[model samples]
Target: MSTTERPRILVVGGGYVGLYAAKRIMKKMRYGEATVTVVDPRSYMTYQPFLPEVAAGSISPRHVVVPLRRVLPKAEVLTGRVTTIDQDRKVAVVTPLVGEAYELPFDYLVIALGAVSRTFPIPGLAEQGIGMKGVEEGIGLRNHVLEQLDKAESTTDENVRRKALTFVFVGGGFAGAETIGEVEDMARDAAKYYSTIKREDMRFILVDAADKILPEVGPKLGTWGKEHLESRGIEIYLNTSMDSCVDGHVVLKNGLEVDSNTIVWTAGVKPNPALARYGLPLGPRGHVDTAPTLQVQGTDYIWAAGDNAQVPDVASRKAGVENAWCPPNAQHALRQAKVLGDNVVSGMRGFPQKEYEHSNKGAVAGLGLHKGVAMIVMGKMKIKLKGRLAWYMHRGYHGMAMPTWNRKIRVFADWTLGMFLKREVVALGALETPREEFYEAAKPAPAPAAAAAPAQKAKAS
Candidate 1:
């Protein structure tokens, strides 16, 4: 590394904010003044909003992720994790996917590591619960659900069948609610092909610790959503928590217990703990604290955004709140990234940096294919929508916001083709170990009868 070379800008985590921020910076920078590098464990950026549809077989898992290399052609993309950042030394310890650790010195840094699923030390949760945070998890959940149907159809034991058919979701947020609804709809449709498992035989339960779900949408729509899910035979357990899910047996705090093979955990997420190792200034909740301009406090060269940053919300000023922080969501992440990117260039060029401010646009959630709830805020008025129309709006908004044009077209194509094609419900449970069955069957057996007879004749002669 030459000291006289171009100033290096290192962006950590190739998530929604990292990808877009790097792209925005690269687009703004002129020929070779600074070098931008993005580091993440994955080479693709997952469009997480469509994960529920992917799990439900509405979209191909491949279509829901945007490849970083394709989108950031100008920036050097490194597939790795940043183990630690020495702010005083201005170096990041990066461990590549298949190599030894190396020190990456940077003139500027962007902390966009994002958040991880918040989990508790409950018994059997680590072993039994599944999450819907990534593309692989979405695909696994899809296969697991289909495999449950197969198990229920083939098994003659009533207890085993009952256990296989019951599915429990431990969160009532958008991820949990949308996932359960889509999966339930998929399972119901798949029952048509099964001779033994009927739609009514399967059970879907959604549990949340809060009094209401979809708090991003106001109270009225949230209440409507709870009622809507309950009317469809989906049990809603609000203001309750799961006591234990030991060995696929879920015990709720309300004294309700059930045996379920599939347990999806989407309760919530906390900032990635890896950020703390970087020695940056973090808030009480473990998120990097940033100024209103999206710059890391007390640092002129480092910036942070996305779920990992506590960016103050300037838009909340109308409500008489001062320095209100922004919430961690896709909408905020996307906008914050753009501002952070521009601010980076502004800092580099010695220009005035702009402040970050955006009011809540409300939220929209899809319950299933044609069901949803939305609350859109326009100035002083807040409008609520539900049912099929809201569902269309939900899909339309996310479909357009699905990132790159390549992925946008692919996602829309998946939705378009879904109208004419039948949903695929085949479970490739053995996908992880394709050769296990073959290897077991091909193991050497005892000597065959003909070989044994030949040996015996030779001995007798």
Candidate 2:
């Protein structure tokens, strides 16, 4: 930024796409070819697939995030946000964590702003629903769930106990299914320690508008998953959406209603709303439109990928599918990022750009510790797995897919230790407001004059 002489590459939103794309570009470019700069609100990139484990207390929150600065040492990492972009002038306005907004000029730009949690305007959702988008939310969810158990155990009133014991999860996809599965497992284990609370006393309900759960894994497996969860006493209402959840009262379209203190929303995600402010070509769903080569439409210097970009899936098209597009998942994001980086380098050097094309490899889902489902597609051959073996597939795939070697080793270590140690079920709900106790102790007490004024006035009367 100090000098406009050297070419600059700016990557916005340091998530999976931004982090991997920046690393790829830095690795490919020669010395002094171009400078790479990354900007995001957080200084770390979170491995989102591990969020479920974090929420279940299977993994520490810190290990799930990769420090952007440590990973991208050669690149300029700015902890802030890009408020607006004037692509006509090739300038972006950046607002740091604590500073005046400034404009940054870049020769090339990569939009990896990613997506945010998608939610409906359901009643009381904003106040009561919990999300699993980030590490903080995951940690908060863990504490809140365990705290609910405490509330159920300590309460004497039957209404309060029942309300505290009821758990509701909205959505049937990977996040909702996995979160409820792991959390239910954790609660089942934690019940052993509580004298009054038992696993049979708790009620878990999963509500989704779809006809089936885990549709990504096909109908047969999805049905199996539903049955498996139901056998464990989970109430799943498929094709049933939540009508309202006001004042801890949950009403479903199917006429079933319940009072619950916990309501989780993991329905879906939409592209970042900031994409509209960038003055770029967007798809119907508000994602940046990009070519197969990953360059933003109608522009050579700008590129986009991951959940924010509507990149055409060439492999699917080649396979005789029309209007095919890549799904917004970590698998595609990681692969698209490398291709985007290569295309950016090629564009800089006037070389031919390579088109992005990748076929579906497979899918895996973990139900709990030793339960899961996996479908592996190898060319024309398909392999299906379930139970403990499929659980291994889930762990193996995501464990290796984790960002860096440092992280991979640490995650594996956590799992190894988990096998030998007791599960940590203690709820640290105080983390939500860590400074509350300090503030209470450190705040100035009421003045003696203020305390004595009421007594003195009464004496005068």
Q: Which 10-residue window in model 1 sums to the lowest lDDT?
A: 1-10
What is candidate 1's CA lDDT for residue 74? 78
* Model 1 CA lDDT for position 443: 96
Considering every candidate listed, which one attains the maximal lDDT? 2
Please give, for residues 1-461, the per-residue lDDT of candidate 2 as tens digits.
35547799999999999999999999999998998999999999999988989988898999999999999998999889999998888899999999799999999999999999999989988888999899999999899989988998898999999998899999999888888989999989999988999999999999999999988788888899999999889999998898889998999999999999999999989999988889999999999999999999999999999999999999999999999999998889999999999999999999988999999998999988888988899998878887899999999999999999999999999999999998999999998888999999999988799889999899999
Q: What is the C-alpha lDDT of each candidate?
A: 0.91, 0.93
**Which residue pairs collide in model 1, if any?**
none
Give lDDT tens digits, candidate 1, residues 145-235: 9999998888899999999999999998899989998998899889999987788999999999999987878888889988998888899
**Which ranges in model 2 have alpha carbons more than 4 Å from their true place?**
1-4, 448-451, 454-461
Tell me how many residue pairs clash in candidate 2.
0
TM-score of each predicted structure versus truth: 0.95, 0.97
RMSD of each: 3.0, 1.9
